[model samples]
Target: MKLFSLKKTFFLIIVLLGLTATSFAISNDALRQQLKLFSETLSYINANYIEVPDQKELIYGAIQGMLSSLDPHSAFMKPETYQDFQTDTRGEFGGLGIQIAVRDRVLTIIAPIEDTPAYEAGLKAGDRIIRVEGETTEGMSVMDAIKVLRGEPGTDVTITIWREGLNVGKDFTITRDIIKVNSVRSKRYGDIGYIRISNFNENTSRELRNELDKLEKKPIQGVVLDLRNNPGGLLSQAIEVASAFIEPGKLIVYTEGRTATRNELSARRFDDKDRDYPMVVLVNQGSASASEIVSGALQDYQRAIVMGTTTFGKASVQTVIPLSDGSGMRLTTAEYFTPKGRAIQDVGIVPDIKVRSGKVVSDESSMDRVSPSAVPEHLMSDSEELDSDNGAPEDDLQLLRALDVLKALNAFGGTYSRN
Candidate 1:
């Protein structure tokens, strides 16, 4: 029975090799040489290894290595990992609630989802996760790190993080919970409407439309769309968001890939005319993927004055192909481009007006003798006020800047109209 198992494995390997050779159009001689080398290496390891390795593990490792060599985003997802990934897209899952990626070969935090355990614990963007549960993450894949960080709710996971402007690495013990993301939040600043998007999920577009409808009830002079710390999600949601503001029949974004079937996603004519209000978009280094797509499209069309810092620049489109073993492959299948033909892969969207975030004021004298309760909530300093429910500080310097820009546009004879 053992001999038969080995023979079946050998046959499977040969069949896989033949398929690869045929797909790539490799010459018969070259294909034979490659297969011979692979067979010899397998035999040598099986015969001379100090400890026998599991055949399945060896094969999985090989597949992982191949995918990792292509790109950081492309990866082989084991069956369990694939299941967790599907759960994540539904907007509720048990985890740290931080979007992470392997940036510069380090496990880096892209953005912490708002109101989640990680965000409430003050885990900032660009923080490097050095250790998880005392185990080093030096050679760990993004998916592996995710597995360790996420588990049953009510569990605790300690992670050591190295951050900029810090002398020593800090360890944080975060309790996992079911993360439900509220993608859109809105506030009225007299005639200006401020909307903050935490992340793009399935409900993002609908939530944004609902918020916009509520804001439209009041007189709106201008709009500030904040995309700071927004680690992007579904591409379809991004398209829907952009369609809300952009004109019908306008090209929002186009993608190019090796195959023609999955390329080019253009904007559909969802409405008669675009929203004709002066607009400013706020973005920062944490804004990535779908966030970049929306901001890039608006900027290219001159529909909005993009403010704040540059974006995170994750412009590749990944497609998940399921395997027969219940596993799957998340492959970087295409590169997306803005309407003006600008590539945002590693080069992020540059803001029209660059404004750095202002420092939080902690001085008591700056309060201007008015009692905290007497002062209007929007007029109070962000540092002095905290959201009661989430305990997260509402420090939004970028939003303030966007409002200022909108006011300026409104003042100058309403020059920046959305035509």
Candidate 2:
């Protein structure tokens, strides 16, 4: 059986060499030489190694090395890891509830989901995860780190984090839980509508539509769409959210790859004209991917004014393809651009009006002091914690600026073209 396996492997290599000769520009002779060298190395390792090694593991490692050389986002996942990847889109998973990415070859926190153990523990965006359970995460992939960070509910793991302002890494011990993301929330600021999208998930579109339905019942002149600290999720949900405001069949985002010329995605939902009130979109350094798509598309169309700090700037599109062994690979096939051809890869969407982070304080000494209690319980900010929630302060500086601009737009009674 073992001899047969070795023969089959060499046979597969020969087939690959033949395919490579026809597909690639490299000379067939040189390519054949390289394949021969690889086969010899594998054959030697299998025969002369002190102990027998798992052939499956050896193959998986080779695939991972190849993909890792391409980009940080492209990775080879094992069967179990691929299963977890599917669960992520549903927005219900057992873990710390933080979106992470490998930026500059370091495991960086994109954003901590609200109402999760990680967010409540005060994990902020741009924080680097240095260690997990006392094990250094120095050379760990994002998927490996995720496996260690997640476990059965009620269990706990300690992660050491390093942030920009911190002198040294800090350790945080948080319990695992089934994080069910309530991606959309809303509030009313008098005549203005406030829709806060924490992240784009499968539930986001349905929830956002419901929120929009509720807001439409009221006479809202404008809306403040808050997307601060929102590490974006499913791309489909991003288009759906944009379609709530942008009319049908208009370009929302376009992607281009080496082999592919252009693939354009457009707003599809109808009845967007009714929600075409003057709008202000709120974003910050934590808002990325799908978040950038919606914000950039709106800005390009002049449909809304974006306010607050710049976005997190993740514009690469990852395509997950399954392999024969139930494992898979997430390959970075293309980079995405906004409708007006603005690239968002490392260059995040710049807000039309930049507002510094601050608290909005009315005349505290005046008799008209609006205390925290004065604000209705239902009208409270969507921030999980006051420290990390850039969009929600007692009275948010960015939110106030957005409302002020929307109010101004309402006063001007301007009419803009729809998709």
Candidate 3:
């Protein structure tokens, strides 16, 4: 939602480029001819048109047309469009709160965010959205389907979904809520520290560090890093997180764009402070981008045991280039790879353990609904506190499985401890 001051920065860059480049100069003759052609086209369009056109709309259309020729990520977003981006990334949108990705023409549910309306509505990991409000979504774009699903909070929207082995389409009348995605959820479950990351945002690294410090003071066994529904955020945050458990001087991730300027990133040399904790990272089809960067690097280095399904393969790095105007373009500038030099584009990281979230439920009866007081005294420490309610207690079977593994590892004294 914050406006970035990039006009001056762009102008400065242009000035520097002009000074550096001696041979590659724009000819005045060619520029004059291009301007003449542009004026002629504009005149022609204005003189012979079916309907009167707005000048601003024409300019926006031209910009949109140009951007459409580029990659899918490079888009011309209006003020409202930017607001939509903010709502989605913050996970505070007024909608079903279910992340969907279209593949094979079917809108499949990614892992629903914890404590969201969608999670509460019993949406599972692999449920297919067949219809919304009575309209068929057979040939709709992902963006269009998302728009139809979002509305004023407290309003109800009926969604028809088809899941595996289900002969009949399941209809869910879900209420729209002001979904605020709590990026991090941490608590001591028995001897292990359970950390659920909904997404890797700007505050993620700090949140994770604070949670770990709390757990470190107690009799902690190990930590379960749940990255199941995370769509990922800033690359810097991902590297910071991966550096916590991984050794210094290791390759965390690397980027390769067409230009040499936007190329490399490596891990630090001495991240020995938070390096002595056994970790199990939970990932699924929704874990992607910066999430993959952290999980893939950890998995390659054997720093953490990855559990759940394969990641949502998104390895492209976007560079936000602002124009002279307030609007900007988020262009996919690079392809990223894991530390072990594996391309994660379309090919995600395979977890050490694979567990599905299972079938979708329709009502609250399927959830366990653990209260804050339900966490036994043995489960909490002076520094650690439990969340008020257990999140999607039934649909989060993958997280439960990961916790079980961590508990077992603790029994074997495999929770990494430094001498």
Candidate 4:
């Protein structure tokens, strides 16, 4: 019996070795073939093309296609594109200062950053950018349009916009300026403290902390955190911000991926500031990435009342890997889950109070739009006629409703039982 067992062990070892060898050989062959195919395709495109395509554009397009094929978030970044990303994360850039994204192959305005040139020039969300400086934006990528938008401070750029609900398209000749995004905008509406966070960038946590601290000294009955039209940023910042409301040692988020170490981010002990305040978080289709982390964690832990539309449903974590050539890859590395082990990829967080804001041209009265607190039109969208206190006409109407919810919670004196 002993002899037979030893033979069986030896056979298993040999089989494992054979499998490893085969896998390694297959991987090498696959890589070689891919490289050869890339070379051939590039050569063919350059040698024979209708318009004599720019070599740099062709190379960048290939890289973008390669990454985009993996997932929507993973993307290639050239030097300028990478720089624009850095500026965005830093919460500052030079442009008309409008938040934009590509949807259906068109540049759609998500929102206008407060006090920016875009907001001042009457730019509104849902505006379709058709032409930039007389150049049609039909075949342009988001990064390409951004490059055209960004320029030296005080420069002017003409943007042709096809706005929804408008009788005729509008043209805005906006002068560029240095857009310094506060990232976190805070105020006191009656007894409720309201805070609007644009993104979870590197300085997000610190900015949020400062804002929270400012409200702590006041007799603020409740707080509203608005995270709408935020594309998300640093993961660490998300955890830090969530920890402010949740108790220590609570699981905030976790991530798992093939061949990646499973990571669990928990809320650590904070300084106990504003721990007893009733909190309401707002989110929408524009809230994603790190914003999802905060909203998901808060909702799962039952630490706050979430009021808004469904979140953006981006639960994948990306790592920006910088190469030697100043280019980088925003690669999706892992899928994140809330503390309840619920995957949010393609499934966004459901709000406790689901409210729908009115459209720009809807016949509904301003009273039909519900906000926890009274908000003026200028506080949200740039337009006067469409903008109303009910929070319609703004891209992030869900967040405004969340502020209203916080005001309601404040009126309840933090004594209402959460169901």
Q: What does candidate 1's lDDT look like per residue over 285-316, in tens digits?
A: 89998999999999988999999999888899
Query: lDDT score, residue 125, model 4?
Result: 54
TM per candidate: 0.88, 0.87, 0.69, 0.73
* Candidate 2 residue pairs in backbone clash: none
Give the alpha carbon lDDT tens digit for every residue of 331-417 in model 3: 667899887789998888888777876644566798778776876554443214223334323456776677666655655555432
- Model 3 ranges off by over 4 Å: 1-50, 53-72, 86-93, 100-109, 126-151, 156-173, 260-262, 267-272, 323-326, 357-419
CA RMSD, predictions in order = 5.3, 5.9, 10.0, 11.8
Best candidate, lDDT:
2
lDDT of each: 0.83, 0.85, 0.71, 0.73
Question: Scored by Cα lDDT, where does model 1 land?
Answer: 0.83
Cα lDDT tens digits for candidate 2, 196-314: 99999989999988888887786777888999899999999999999988988999999999987899999996454556578999999999999999999999999988889999999
- For model 1, the stretches where C-alpha displacement exceeds 4 angstroms are 1-4, 28-35, 269-274, 360-395, 414-419
Model 1 misses residue 168 by how many Å?
2.7
Lowest summed lDDT window (length 10), candidate 3 = 1-10
- Report the poorest 10 consecutive residues by lDDT, candidate 1: 383-392
Candidate structures ordered by TM-score, highest first = 1, 2, 4, 3
